[model samples]
Target: MLIPQYLFDAEAFLAFRIIEEKFHVISKSRISLLKLQLLHERALHRGHLKVAQQACDELGALASPVTGVDADLKTEVSLRHARTLLAANQFSQKSGNAALGLPYALASILFCQSFNLDLLKASATLTLAELWLSHGPSEAERALALLHGVFPMILGHGGLELCARAHITEAKCHLSDPSYSVHHKPDLVLSPLKEACEQLELLEYHELAAEAFYLMAMVYDKLGNLEEREKAAASFKEHTLALRNPQESVDDILNMI
Candidate 1:
């Protein structure tokens, strides 16, 4: 059955931003399912395991109550919560078995990319796709295709940064495959990486440019193209100081994914 992407997008969007304010109480009869994704991420980064676990527990509660006055809301919160759990590294599943949250996350992410079309959703989807790819080769091939297909979908709507990021993601996914090895060919992933760098340059997103350039250098190195590798490395260093605040950055956003 063809599910409604609009409804999914709105549901996921609300789940992602459920906590607009601490004082706001009651939301049309449903619980105020808060979004504390950032809190858990930040807590872990700061070595606050307790805080991170608390966030996880909060996610579980938010994800609970599959049947209630707000059924759709429950499903949406559960999906976001599952995505959060998958991202937190606090859960594990057997080999060759997809985690419970992953399939739901992937479905909503695709729905967002195919129909919802928003910058935040695009970024989130790409991040989840990367995670899916990291599971190994089979997932990598699927993710490579998905990233390529979604790139155009996001191009016009995801803003300059997100579009560039999508290209970079496509490039990285390509690099994950054996066909991308320089021994076989020097161009498998270079095109998109270069495109991403160029887009970043146009947008004056220098920090992101640095990362793209660095990855380009690695690809060139693998190709044994010392001159091109040197050039890319130089460019990467040139953009280093131009980066945004290290604490809050374009690169860091990619990491958050």
Candidate 2:
């Protein structure tokens, strides 16, 4: 289960083999659950979606027959499966498959709502909004409608990372809205994008932060503010490099300024 420390393919494969061997011999349900969780996470990290899905399916089967704390685990696992599918759909090469994650997102939202899991509900809502936004201008209004309540929901129960994503999604909806864009008001997106970038930086999610900065740079360029554009562009580059070399000190990035 010490897979995170040594994520090399060979090590991961060996660990998986060992885990599978132990799983068959293990009698404790909790121990088996932990092993499955580790396999699920490691497979997802390695982009082995089929393996992750199988792990998730096994987790559901293991958790479904239990109650009390295990019931909570079941719900959490369900949500996680939904999230993994959503991520896969979002990153898919087929833009035409934007609806791929919709059913899972909706199901997760319903599952969370039934349990009164407000935080997970909000998170699932955000995921649904993102999926809608991915449909381009045709679904922008629907995305905005969902986003209108998402910020307040995230603020109330969600953590900084979710809040950052909410801000970014809100900004994306505005950017994609024909009514908003046709007015030539690209600056309207800058505020939320800036908030997203700040929150992502604070969370040390440099890859996503870089994307937010790149969007801000584009907005600044649209506003004809070359200086602000350059600044945002520089930040984007710095964050991008930080993601590639995480061990590099802050001073290393600062020196590029």
Candidate 3:
């Protein structure tokens, strides 16, 4: 069945249903990988963890036979699988299993290293750092070190959205740093967050931008900057509403400001 790309980009429920109905037929073809990847990304973007997981599982199955597949293809699959695993783990709140994502992350990192895929290596590194970040402040040190190492790669070779993600991760690392509270330094966190929001807004990554704005509001509140906090909070609300109502016009969202 030839499915239109826009069908996969349609409303989440409809997309999920269409994909599920055609999955068995589609999985037999060479285009399956691309289709599954697109589904995984769209599902993840729409916060449909189960649908993403379904796509990831099929991707994992396709990549299971390691003998004849192209090295780069395998590595890309590994990275996406790791990302999906991490997202699922985060959404499930499977307590005491914080390291549930560790092996998948390590596999992706190792695949990147072995294949000498530098840009992908940087992404895999970021995923590892994110996993470490979830382990708390003690692990934030390790995560920060990795984030620092990848920033150059992400900024120099990665796309704008990836660069924005790196900035957001860096800000999160700082926020999670115990020293941040002790030193009462909001600027270190705020600067990167501001940059991240700019990039995210430019890309129209509304949900992620909403998250960045929410963080900014918290940071401003901590620093006793009520005016800035109010602005950030307003932006957060605007972006959040935009995310919920994806059909909302840019002018409508801007009018909320």
lDDT of 2: 0.70
Candidate 2 wrong stretches, greater than 4 Å = 1-62, 65-74, 182-187, 244-257
* lDDT by residue (tens digit), candidate 3, 1-257: 33422242444445545675787565544456666776766666655666667777777777657564666677776677667776666556675334766776787778778778899989988888888887888898899999899889999999766787788889989888877771366678888899999887776677668878999999988878899999999999998887676653333222221
Candidate 2 pairs with clashing backbones:
none
- Give the Cα lDDT of each candidate: 0.58, 0.70, 0.73
Candidate topping lDDT: 3
**Residue lDDT tens for model 1, 124-228:** 566567567757766777877667665665786776556776777677777777666656755657877887887777655565578789999998888788999
Q: Worst 10-residue stretch by lDDT in candidate 1?
A: 1-10
lDDT of 1 at 74: 36
Candidate that scores best on TM-score: 3
Deviation of model 3 at 214, angstroms: 1.1
Return the clash pairs for model 3, or none: none
Q: Name the lDDT value of residue 116 in candidate 2.
A: 84
Clashing residue pairs found in predicted model 1: none
* Candidates ranked by TM-score: 3, 2, 1
Residue 95 in candidate 2, Cα distance off native in Å:
3.0
TM-score of 3: 0.79
